[model samples]
Target: MFVNKAYRFRLYPNKKQEVLIAKTIGCSRFVFNRFLSLWNESYQTTGKGLSFNFCSSQLTQLKKELEWLKEVDSHALQSSLKNLADSFDRYFKKQNEAPRFKNKRNNVQSYTTNIEKKNQNPEVSIAENRLKLPKLGWIRFANCREVKGRILNATIRKSPSGRYFVSLLVETEVKEIPKTASTVGIDVGLKDFAILSNGKVYKNPKFFRALEEKLAKAQRILSRRQRLAIQQKRPLSEAKNVQKQRIKVARIHEQVVHARTNYLQKISTEIIKNHDIIGIEDLQVSNMIKNRKLAKAISEVSWSEFRTMLEYKAKWYGRQVIAVDPRHTSQKCHSCGHTAKENRQTQAAFICVSCGHSENADINASRNIHELAILL
Candidate 1:
C-alpha cells in the first residue's frame, strides 16, 4: 500500500541562513496577500476571480517588478499562490471562512516548496545531520530518525516559541502490523484522560493548568513591557524587553502543547498496540465546549487531538477504530440494557433504575460503546 507521511525535525541555521529564511517567509506571505487582493478586486470588478494558472502566470511579472521577491525560492512563491487558490476554493464550497490577508504579527511564519522529480525520485536528500531544500542549502538538523521514501514537499516554519522546524511530506509503501487478539473501548473525560472497558484509567495530566502560574506571570511581564514601549512612543517590535517577554510567554504555551502531545501520543500508541478493534464515543466536542462551566476543562483535555491520533495510528498499525454514538452511553445499564436519565446516579456512578445494575459510570459507557461498535 502507498501512504503519505510527514516527519518534522528541528533545524539549526546559521545567521545568514536565518536571514534568508525570514526573507523567504516574508516573500511568501507578501505573494499570498497580493494574490488575494488581486483576486478580490477582480471578482468585484469582473464577477470572477483569477484562477491558479492565471495567478501563477502573473507571478513572473510580479517577480520582475519586485526584486526582493526574487531573493526567495521561486517554487515557494508559486506555492503561496496555490495556497490562496485553495483557500478561495474552500470558501466558495462553504468548507471554511473566506481568505484573509496575511499579517506579519499574527500569521504563522511558513512556506512550502515541492521537490523536483527525477527518475521517479525526488531531488531532495538528507545526509548525516543535514537536509537540503531548493534555494536554502543543506541545513543542520537534529537527526532523530532516518527519513524514508520519496520526498514530495517540505514546509519550513518558525513556531511562536521562536523555534525553527521543517516538516517533510514523503510518499512511502506501508507495512501493516500483525493482528492483535484484543479489542477495547475508551471513554474520555476531563477528570480522567480516558477510562477503558478493561478497567484501566489514564489520569488527565492537565498540562496547561500545571503551567498556568508561570504563563500568567510571563504574560503580566509582557503586558508591562508593552505598556512601557507605548509610553516611550516606540513600536513594540523595536522594544527589546517586549520582544524577549513575548518569547517567554510563547515558550510557556509551547511547553504546554509539547507536554500534551507527548502524553497523548504515548497512550494512543499503547492502545493501538494492544487492540485490534478500538471503540470510542463520537464526541461532539465543539458543541460540548458551549457549556461555559466545562469549556476550559474540555479544551485542556483535547479530546479531538486524542481521537485524531488514535485514528491515524490505527490505520498505520492495520487496526480498526470505531466511533459509536455517545447518546445515553453513560445512562444505559451495561448489565440489563436499561437506559434512563436516573440510571446515572452521580458524576462517577451508574445504577440502573429498571434493573438495579450498578457500575462505574465511565466504564459502563465504554462497555456500551464497545457493544455498539460490535453491532455496527
Candidate 2:
C-alpha cells in the first residue's frame, strides 16, 4: 500500500544559497502573518474568514506591489497561504486554537514548497550529496540514507542553533512485515518508559533530566548575555554574544530532544516488529500535566510522542494498536478482577484487598489493558 513518509536531512548551503533561503523564509512568514491578520478582520466583519482563492489572488497583487516578494520562490508564498487556510479549517473544526501570527524572533522557522511535475526532471530532486530546491539551486546535504520514492514537496527549516534542515515528503509503497502472531499490552510510566504484559520493562532514559543541570548553566549564561545586550542598548538579535550564547543553550535542548526521539523510535520499532496486536492505555497527558508537581516529569517522559510513534509504526507494519480505557487499570487486580484503591499498595506494587492477588503494579495494569483490548 502507498504511504506518505518524510525523510529529513541536514542541509549545507553556500553563503548565496543561505541568503536566498533566509529571504524565502522571511517572505513566507510575512505572507502567513499578513493573511492571518486579514482573516481575523474579515471574520470580525463578515462572520467568515477569507477563502484560500481570495488569499491567493491577494498574494498575487501583493507581489506586484512589493517587488521583494517576487525575489523568492513564488510557490513558497502560495504554500504559506495554503497553510493559513489549513489553520483556519482546523480552528473551525475545533482541532486546534485559532491561528496566530508568525513571529520573526522565533528560534525555529520553516517554509513549505511543492514540486512541479510538468517536466520529467523536477526541480526538487536529490542527487550525489546535493538537493536542488526551487530558486536556491543545488545545495549540498548530508546524504545519510538513500532517499526512495517519488518526491512530493519539501519543508525547509532553520533550527534554533542556526542549522538548516529539509524534510522531503514522498509517496512510496510499503510492505507489511511478517507478524509474530503474538499479542501484548503496554503500561507506560515515569519510572519505566514501558512495561509489557510479558513482564518485560523498557527503562526510561530521562534524557532531559540527565542533562538538566548542564542545560540550566547554559541558559543562565544566555540570560546574562541578554541582560548585557539590553544594558548596552543593543537589540538581542544584533548582539553577537547574546546570539552565540542563545545558540549554545539551544544546542543543549536539541541534544536532549535528539536523544529522546532516538530512544522512542527504537522502542516503538521493536514493539511493532514483534507484536500482532498491541494494547495501550488511552492516557490524557494534557490533563495529567495539570498537576504541577508531576508536570516536568510527565513532559520528560513524552508519553504522547511515544504513543504517536507506536500508532504510525503499527499502521506501517499492518499491526493493531488498541487504546483501552485507562480507568482502574492500575488499581484492578489482574488475576481476580478485584478493583479498589487499596489494591495499589504503592506506586510499584499491587495487591488485591479482597482476593489476596499480588503483582507488579505496571505489569498488572498492562495485563488489565490486554484483557480490555481483547474484550473490546
Candidate 3:
C-alpha cells in the first residue's frame, strides 16, 4: 500500500532570497484574504457559499488585474489561491461543516493544485532548483529531500516557529510488506498522554506546565513594554524595541511547540512500530473542556495534538489507526463486556456494577479501545 506524506525541509537562503520568499508568501496571503472577503460578501447576499471553482476562477482573474503580479509569476499565484480554495472545500467536507471565512495565510506556505496530469518537471528538477513562480519567479527552497514518483500535489506552510514545510501527495506503486505485529488500542488522558493495549503508559510530561512560570513572566514584561511604548507616542523606530520583546515571546511559544511535537512523535513512533493496528477513542475535546476545573490542565496536555500525531505516524509505519466512539470507553468493563455509567465510580477508579470486576479507570478504557479495534 502507498500513502500521502508530508516531509519538512529547512531552507537556507541569503538575505535577498529570503526577502523574495517573504514577498511571495505575502502576495499569496493577500489573494487568499481578498477571495475570502469577496466570498463572505457573496454568501451574505445570496445565502449560498461560493464553490471552490468559483473562488479559484475569480482569484486567477483578480491576479491579472494586479500590475505588479505580472512580474512575479502567474502559475505560482493561481496555484496558491487554488490551494486555499481546495483546503476550504476539504475542511468543510471532512468536518461536515460549512466554511464562512477565508483563513489567514501567514508565512512561507503557498499551495499548488493537482490537475489531472502530473507535473513532469518535478520540484527536484525545477529551474535553478528555485522553483519558478508567478511574480516571485524562481525563489529558493530547501532541497534536503528529493521528490519521488508522480507528483500529484504540493502544499507549503509555515509553522509557529517560523519554518517552511511542504506536504506532497504522490501516486506510487504498491509494495507488499509482511505484517510484524497484531492490532492494539490506545487511550489518551491528561495525566498520561497515552495508554496502550500492551499495558504501556506514557506519562504526560506537561511540557507547557514546566515553562508556565517563565512564560508568564515574559508575557508580563512584553505587556508592560508594549504599553510604555504606546503611552510615549514614540516614533516607528521606538516600536523596534517592543517588537524585539514580542519576538522573545514568540520564541517561547516556539520552544513549547518544538518540545511537544518531538515528544508526541517519539511516543507515536514507538507505538506504531510495535503494532499493526492502533485504536483510540474519538474524543470530543471541546465538550471535555467545558469542565471549568479541568480546562487548564486539559489544554496543557493537548490530547488532540497527540491523536493527530498518532494518525500520520501510524500511516507512515504501515499501521492502522482506528478512532472508536468516545462514549462509555471508561465505564465499560473489559472483563464482562458490561457498559454502564455506574461502572466508573470516580475519575481514576473503575468497578463494574454488573460484573463486579474492578480495575484502573484508564486501563479499563485502554482495554475497551483494544476490543473495539479488533471488532472494527
Q: Give the TM-score of candidate 3.
A: 0.77
For candidate 1, the per-residue lDDT at 194 reads: 98
Task: List the candidates' TM-scores in order.
Answer: 0.96, 0.96, 0.77
Write one digit per residue (lDDT tens) for candidate 2, span 236-353. 8899989898888888989999899999999999999999999999999999999999999999989999999999988887999999999999999998898999999999989899
**Model 2 scores what on Cα lDDT?**
0.92
Candidate-wise lDDT, in order: 0.90, 0.92, 0.70
RMSD of each: 1.6, 1.4, 4.4
Best by lDDT: 2
Candidate 3 CA-lDDT value: 0.70
